[model samples]
Target: MATWPNAAIATLMETCGEAVSNAAWNAILNIVFPCPTYLVAPEQRLDSSRPDLTVYIVGENGVFFPFEGKPAKFSWEKLGGEVLGYCIAARPDAFQGYNYGMGGNGPECIICEYDGANMRYLYIHEGELCQSDKMHVLHIFRDAAEILNVLEFVRGAHV
Candidate 1:
């Protein structure tokens, strides 16, 4: 896959243009990810529950990432469990088999939590939902360059 880290972020920022709602973020992602390379589906059902956004690889049945967006004021602790549940329900095989430091063989799925300005990356490790301190929290405005890395990782291209 081609890597255009800055390009994706730039498109997202341009599309949203400071808008912070879940719908706005979803729209930005849809514009950023088009079709063939990725399919961005909103309010997709993962088992009996639905996540705010579900990204899938082109022609693939499994999910690449499950995303949940909220306002900037929402508490991470309260929303963390819900995002984790969606990841588990959406891709049980990847979540259950994920192991820390296993390179490309590690978990391929991610649960993305973003609030207008900030974004959080969550993954399943050793039967528990965890976030690395380094990438636990990312700011959209300040960390524009790094956003591409997050997108690539979630797309299973950086694993």
Candidate 2:
């Protein structure tokens, strides 16, 4: 993960709606990668649903992670439920989401997935877990390890 400027964080914190949040989140994610390794597609439409963003590994077919996005304030329950639904619909091992900020505390991430036949969801602020189905949260963008893990998941899914 790149070290983002405080100004970027401030803009995200002030984002007022789903659209702005998604756009900002998309821009940040693109900046996270140098392109051609993994690609972040905003508002990509799938057959069953349209995810707010879809992360894809280049040159790999059918290997993608669908994601939802919400502004600073939103229904966590709603985000969790929708991501889980995406998991079921897309039938991937996992799904993800981004909340521009969580109650103005900072950005949060939501991950919903099947863990050995049991489904779980996590709401994370930075690297901290708030509402969780597991002992830890999926802090997708918190650090390099976390970002690599997501890439591994995407690659492993199609293998």
Candidate 3:
């Protein structure tokens, strides 16, 4: 919709540490959704917790998507809870919601789906959880296309 080439997403995936990653992701996040048609609260609070952002359309009421990002030194143990918190707090209620979220750790990132009825999620794990139990993670170096595919899917799905 924005015609912002998905290939350009490579710039974001290439960032290294926390500050660089956060700023880079923030710039893309601001431009990706654009304006007039969308209302994005970049790096702002969504109720009680905060992700890197909260986003929703201009006329939407009580609906928002929370997004997060991390440096190369990332941990699902800490970030997972935060992402889930953002998802749980921001989801559209009354009828139903997508309950979807995405996060990045430097170039490595994952899209998350939360099944509220089932209380299930696959994007969270730490040393306590068995390595095999964790879902396969996508590395920027190895899964660039896959990552871009997912972003394209997001653009096509909603826009």
- Top lDDT: which candidate number? 3
Tens-digit per-residue lDDT, 25-142, candidate 2: 5655575544777887765665667777776668765425567777665666777666655555553423333211111112555444544344554343466433346533333235
TM-score on alpha carbons, each prediction = 0.58, 0.60, 0.66
Clashing pairs in 1: none
Give the alpha carbon lDDT tens digit for every residue of 1-159 in model 3.
433224345455464466666555455545555677566676676787678866666776654556788886589666766776676776545124446566767766666555464223333233121122243465644554554455444444452
How far off is residue 31 in model 3, in Å?
A: 5.9
Better of 2 and 3 by lDDT: 3
* Model 2 weakest lDDT span, ten residues long: 97-106
Residue 44 alpha-carbon offset, candidate 2, angstroms: 1.6
Report the C-alpha displacement of residue 136, candidate 2, in angstroms: 7.0
Q: Relative to the true structure, how large is the alpha-carbon lDDT of every model?
A: 0.48, 0.51, 0.56
What's the best-to-worst order under TM-score? 3, 2, 1
The whole-model C-alpha lDDT of candidate 2 against the native structure comes to 0.51
- For residues 1-159, could you state the per-residue lDDT of candidate 1 as single tens digits? 433334445345434422334544454355556677788787778788776677776765766566666555455565565665664565434323441110000101223543223335655445454455333554443443344344534445312
Q: CA shift at 58, candidate 1, in angstroms? A: 2.3
Q: Which of candidates 1 and 3 is the stronger one according to TM-score?
A: 3
Error of 2 at 47 (Å): 2.9
